[model samples]
Target: MKKTSLAGACLLALSLMMGSGAALAKTPPDQLIIGMNMNNLLTLDPAAMTGNEVVGIVVNLYDSLVELDANQLTNVKPALAKSWDISPDGKVLTFHLRDNVRFHSGNPLTAEDVVWSMRRILHLNLAQASVWKSYGFSKKNIDQQVSAPDAYTVQITLPKANDPQLVIYSLAALGNLGVLDSKTVQRHERDKDWGNHWLTTNEAGSGPFILETWQAKDVLRMKRNPDYWRGEAKMNRVVLRHFQESQTLRLMIEKGDLDIASNMAISDINALRKDPQLTVDAVQRGTMYYVAMSMKEAHFANPKVREAVRYLIDYQGINKALMPGYGVLHQRPIKAGMPSTLPDPGYTFDLARAKKLLAEAGYPDGFDTTLRVLSDQPYLNIAIAVQSTLMQAGINAKIITGTGNQVYGAMRERKFDILVGRGGSGMEPHPHSSLRALVYNPDNSDAAKLTNFQGWRTGFYDKQLNEMIDSALLERDAQKQIADYQAIQIRYDQLIPAMIPISQMVDSVVVRNEVQAYQPHPSATTFLRDVWKVDEGDKG
Candidate 1:
C-alpha cells in the first residue's frame, strides 16, 4: 500500500463562501483570506483529528512537541522543546524545554504537561493512535512505550533498543505528538467529554496563532498570538474559507477577492495563470492515482486477473488525455521517497499480454467489473479511459461515481470490485513510515493485518514482512540495511497489493503578492507565524 502523499497545494478560495451575493471585495490591508476544499472540524481535540479537515485546523491550533522539517522528514527541530538527547542504547529520549512557554490560557508549560498529555494520548488510543501505530511500534499495547521521568523529560521505553523507529520519530512528527497542557486535558477528561470540551474548540498552543472561531464546513478563522515563542505574526488575522466549487473560487481570485486560492480547478488553472494578481505554486505531488481492486472476489484474488486489469489501463494515454500533466501514472504500490522493499521495474503497455492473461483467467470474452470513482472530472476521465482500454482487451468496466467520502468508505468496506482513488505516496521520505502500516503491525499495538489489504491471512507473507521489518530495525550495517530493504521490496513486488509503479502528483499554490512567505512544504502549509501580509507593491 502506498502511503498517501499530501504534495498538492491547498485548493479552494475563501471569498466565494462569504456568499452575500455581493461583488468581490478589495484585499484588506492587513488580512489574508485563503480558500480550502472543505472545513469540517468534528472536534479540535487532538485525539479525534485523524482526518484531513481536523488535522488542518489542529495543525494551526496546537503545537506538536517536535516538527518534521520543510520536506516532511530529514530533520527534527524544536517546537516546544529547545533540545533533546537520546541515550547511548536509544531506549530513553530526554528533552530540555524552551523557557517561558505558556498555553493560550496563560498557564506556563511544564514537563508535567508533556507527561500527562502523552499518557492521555496512549490511554485513549483512538485517532492519534492510528497515526502513531504507523510509526512501526507494536508493544503489547500503547501504554508500554511511554514514560515520564520528570516534568521536563519524557522517557520512551521501547521493547528493543535496536529498532530503527527510535531514530525516526522525527519523520512522524506532524502526526505523532502535540504538546498539550496536561492541566487542561485532565480537567476536561474529568468532565467526561474531553472530546467535546471547550479546549477542543479553543486551543492553548505555543504557536504564533490562536484559534478565534471555526464555522464547521464553512470557515476557520485564526488570529495572531502576541506572546508566540517564535515572535509575533506580522499578519493580524488568517481566514480560511471552505469553498466546494472550484469555479466559484476562480471567480474570487479573478476579482482580487482572495489573497490565496489553494485548490484551483483544472479548467481555471490556465486562466488564473494569465492574471497578474495571483501566483500559482505548482509541483508534481507525491500522490498516486490508481485503481484499488477488491480482494474478496475470485477474479481479483488471482494475480493474472489483476495483471490483466493493469494491462487494460492505458497509463500514458490516461496521463495525457484525462489527467493532462496533473500527475504521473502509478503502476506499483510504492512511490518515491517512501521506504519500500519493492524495486521500480515500472510498467509496460502490453495489450496482447493483457488479452492473453484475461483469457487464461477464464474471461475469454472479458468480464465486467464496476469501477467506483469520485465524481470529479479527473477520476471520471480515468474511469472512462479505463473502461475503453479494458474493452480493447475484451473486458468491460462500468464507472460508478460519487462523493469522496462515499467512495473512500466503499473502498474501506471492500464494497467495490475496483475503485479509482488517489493515495499519498510519500508522506515521509522514509520507507519505515510508508511500509509500517502495510507490512507488519507495529510492536506497540494489535492491528497486524494492516498492509495485506487483500485480507491475505497467510502467516507466510505476514511472517516474512515482519521479519524483514524487524531485521531492518536491528541492522546497524549500512550495506545490510540496503540488502534488507531490497528483500522487502522484492516481497512487496511479489504481493502486488494495490500495485502502483509510478507516483503522480499535483502540488501547487496560488497566492496574491499581499500574502508573503508562502513557501510550500511536503506535509502542509507553513505555520501562520511565517505568513505575513505585505504592501500592495510587495505582495509577491
Candidate 2:
C-alpha cells in the first residue's frame, strides 16, 4: 500500500477499535485536544495564580458567583449565584446561591463555602488580595464584611460605598474568585495549612470539568464532570499539550492530530489565515503592553522626563511593522471597549518634542539609563524599537534582557530604572477596575506595599487621583459618575505615572474546521463547555 493509504487504513482500524470500546478508555472519540506553550504556568491555586496559562485551567475547574457572557464580553450573567441585590446605600450586597449545586468532591455548595473561600483569600494575602483590599476588606474586619446569614444567602458589607457592578465583576470567574469545597479542603488541611499545599496540585472546584492530572510544563488533562450542575460537556476529555516551539504546533494541527492551537507565531498565524481547513480568530483582549518607570530613580522622578518618554514612543511604526496581527495602538490606561474609556490623545512620535521636554527638565545633553525587558520575541523587538527612538533624543538607554520572572521580579522589587511590561486592571470592564489598581495609590509607604497594585509597586501616588477614584465609585448619579471617570483620565494625562500606554493586545487562536462555538474570553481564558466538534458525516 502507499504511505497515505497505509496511514488511512491504520486510522480506520483505530476508529473501529474505539467504537468497539477497546480504545475508548484511553482516548475517547469525543476528546478535544489543544496545543500551546505552557511555560508560564506557575501554580494551580487560584489564590496564587498570576499568569494566564493557569487561569485557563482554573476557569474550567472552578465556579464563580457571576461570569462574563461568552458571546458578549461586557455583559455579566449569573453563575453559581442565581440572584443578588444591593442596598440603597450601595454598601451592602446580598447573593442568593443556586440550589443543588455540588462541588467535584460531592459536597453541596453553600453560602458558608462562599464566605470561607473569600476569607481564605484575605488570610493568604495572595496575588488578588490587593483587589479585595481596594474595596476596604481586611483580615481584621473580614467577618463583618463577609457573612452567611443562612445556608443559601451570602451578604457582603463594604466599608465605603462602591459600584455594585464593579463588585460583581470582582466576583466573576476571570477575577479568580472561585468558591471552594470547604469541607473537603478542611478534611485535607494539615497543621493550619488550609489545604494550600494540597490545592497546588489538586482540584476543588464545581465547574464543567474535573482535574485529572497536571505535569509541569508537559501536559494538563481534565475529565468531564459527570454530575456537573451545568449539564454534561459535549466532549468527554480535554487535553492540553505543551509545545515550546510554534512550528511543532503548526505541524500537529496541520496533520489533524491537534484540534486547536492556542499560541502561534505571528508569521505562522498570518499564513494560517489563508488555509481552508483552519479557522483563525483575532479578538481584542483586556490587556495593555506598556513601559513602567520606577520613581526611585531620580532621573525618571522628573515629570518632564516622563512626558518626554511618552513622546519618544513610535506607536504607529511599531504597530505596523512589529505588532501586525498581534496588537493595535491604544494610548490610555483604560483599555478600549470598556465604558467610560477616554479617547486617545494621539501622542505621535516626535523627536523634537522629546528633546524640548528634556531640555526643560534640565537634561538637554540627555542622560544614561537602563531598560529591562523580557528575553523573548515581540517584547525584545519592542525594546529594540524603543532603543532606536531614544537615541534620537540623546537618551542612551541600555537594554537588559531576562525571563518573565526576572524582569517582573525587578519591577516588583523596585530594582529597575525602566521596565517594559504588560498588565491591566480591566478584568472587570469598568473604569474603576483599572484606575483603582493601576493609577490610584492612596498609601505610598513601604508598609503598604501592594505588589498587585502597579502604581504602588512603582511608588506613584497622587492624592487628587486617589480622591477622584473614591468619589467616582461612590457617586450614585449614573451620568455624573461617568463624567467623574472621564475627568480622571484627563488628570492622568497630566501626571505621567509609571506607565505610558503603547498597544492593546490582540490574541489569535486557530481551530480545525470541525470545531464550533469556540469563543475566546477577553481575558484570554478558554471556555470549552460550549465548544463541540462535528464529525465528517455530520457535516454532509
Candidate 3:
C-alpha cells in the first residue's frame, strides 16, 4: 500500500472503531501488513542492531549458515550450508555451502564470503563482536581460525576448548553473523568503517526478501525476491507501519487494515481474545524482565543496599496483576522449565524488611535515586509500581521515561542509577546463554568497554562468579555441568547481584485467522517466506 493509502486507511479504521462499528475493511491478500512500534529499531545493519525488533526484520533479509528449529530450539537445520560435520575431538567444524546461490547484489555466495563476514565481525569489535571474542575469536586470529578451503567449503577451528554446539547455535540464532557479500560491502565502505554507515539502512544478502525502502520510526517496505535460492515468498510485499499507540494497532487489526499486531497492551489483547476472528499467540521466550541497579552509585555499591532493593520489589504481585500477556513469575537467574534450572528462591515484597536493611546499610531514612524505563507499555507500568513500593520504604525513586535508545543507551554507558528492562541472550537452549548475557563480566575496567555485557553495564563483577560460568560452559560431562549451573545460581543470590529477575518474558502477537503458515519463532526469527492469507469466501 502507498503512504497516502495507509494514512487514509488509519483514519478510516479509527472512525469505524469509534463512530459506527460498520463492516470492517480488508487488505490485499498478496501483501502482509504488520503494526508495531519501531522505536527500538535504530539500524538494520545486523552486526550493530540491538533489539529483537530488528532481528525479526534482518532474518527475512539475510540467510545464515543454518536455522534452529522454531519449536525445538536445539535442533539445527541446513540453510546456505547444506551439510556440516564436526571433528572427532569437537574442535573443528566443516560446512559445505550450497551451489549457485547469489546475494541480492547478484554476486555469487561462496565460502569466501562466509569467512569474510566472520572476519568483519571481529575486525569491527562492535556489539555483535563481543560474543565471537568470548568464544576465543579475535581480530588478530579470525583470518586464520575461520578459513574457506574452497569455493564450496568453509571450516571454523575452535581457538579454545569450547563446546562446538554453542558456536553453531550462535551462528544460527544471533542474526548478526549472517553472511554478507564481501565485494558488495567493500564497495560501500566509508572511511574504512567497512560499510557500517551505508548498511545501517541498506542490506546486502541472499535472503527471501529485498528491502524496497525504510523510513526510521515510520514505515518499512520489502518485496519478495523472485529468484531466491530456496523459494519465492508467498506474499508479493511486506509492509510494516509504526503505531505508537497500542489502541491504534488494536483498532487497525479489528478493521482488517493490519494483518497482525505486536507489542499491544495486555488489556487490548484480552479484549481481542474473545473475538473469534483473531488468534493470539503467546510465545514464551527465554528472556526476562529485570530490575537492574548500577553498582557505580555509592548506595548500590553496598550489597546490603542491593538486598534492600530486592525486597522492595513486588515480584509475585507484579506477575499476578501487571504481567498477564507479558510474563510469568520467574525469580532465578537461569530461565525456568529447563532441565538444569532450579526452583524460584521465593523472594517476596516486604517493605519492613527493606526498611530494616536500608537502615543497616547506613541509610537510616533511605535515599533518593532515579529509575530509568522505556516509555512503552508494561515497562512504564512496572516502573510505576516499583516506584510506589520504593516510597513505602522511605526510598524516593524518581521515574524517568524515554525511548528504547535513550533508556538502554544510558544503561549501556553505566549512566543510570536503576533500570527496568527486558533482555538476555537466551535465544539458545543452553544455560550458558542467559548467564553470558546477564551475569558474565570478564573485565570491569572503564577502558575495557564491554558494553554488550549487561553485568558490565551495571558495574557488577565477581571473579568467582565469572570463573564458574566459564567453567560450566566448557564442561563435557552433562550431569556435572548441570550441577555447576545450579551452584552458580545459589552463589549469585548470596552475593546480592546488581540485577534482579522479576518475570520471564512472553511475547504476544495477534494475528487474523485467515493468515496461514505464520509461525512465530521462539528466537524472534519469524520467517515470512511461507506465509499466505485465505479469503473469507474460500473457507467453503
* TM values, all candidates: 0.84, 0.91, 0.91
TM-score of 2: 0.91
1-540, model 2: which lDDT tens digit per residue? Answer: 574475466567656765676623212358888999887786888788876778878988988888887567567788889989988877889999998899998989999999998888888877867788878888788877899999999999986667877888778735477889999988888788778888888979998999999998789999999999889988899999987767667766765778889779988888788888899887887678887888889988999999899889899998889887678999988888756888899988999999999999999989999999998768889989998998889888999999877998988787889887788667677888777657877788878766677887788888988898889988888889879988999998888877887888888888888887788777655678877788745787
Best by lDDT: 3
Arrange candidates, best lDDT first. Answer: 3, 2, 1
lDDT of 3 at 247: 74
Better of 1 and 3 by TM-score: 3
Across 1-540, the per-residue lDDT of candidate 3 in tens digits comes to 575577667777678666875666698889999999898888988788887899999999999999998878889999999999999888999999999799998999999999988888888888788788888999999999999999999999999988888899989988987889889999999999989999999999899999999999899999999889988999999999998777778888987889999989889999999988999998888898999999998989999999999999999889999999999999987887667899999999988889889999998788899999999768998999999998898889999999887999999889999999998878878898899889999999978888878999999999999999989988888899999999999999999999999999999999998899899988888989999999978887
Clashes of 2: 0
* Residue pairs with backbone overlap in model 2: none
| Positional deviation of residue 274's Cα in model 1 after best superposition, in angstroms | 2.3
Candidate 2 has an lDDT of 0.83
Error (Å) of candidate 3 at residue 484 is 1.1
Q: On lDDT, who's better, 1 or 3? A: 3
TM-score of 1: 0.84
Q: Write the per-residue lDDT of candidate 1 for residues 1-62, one digit (tens) a residue.
A: 12112111222223434554656567776777887776444767776565444555566666
Q: After superposition, how far is residue 428 of candidate 3 from its true place, in Å?
A: 2.1
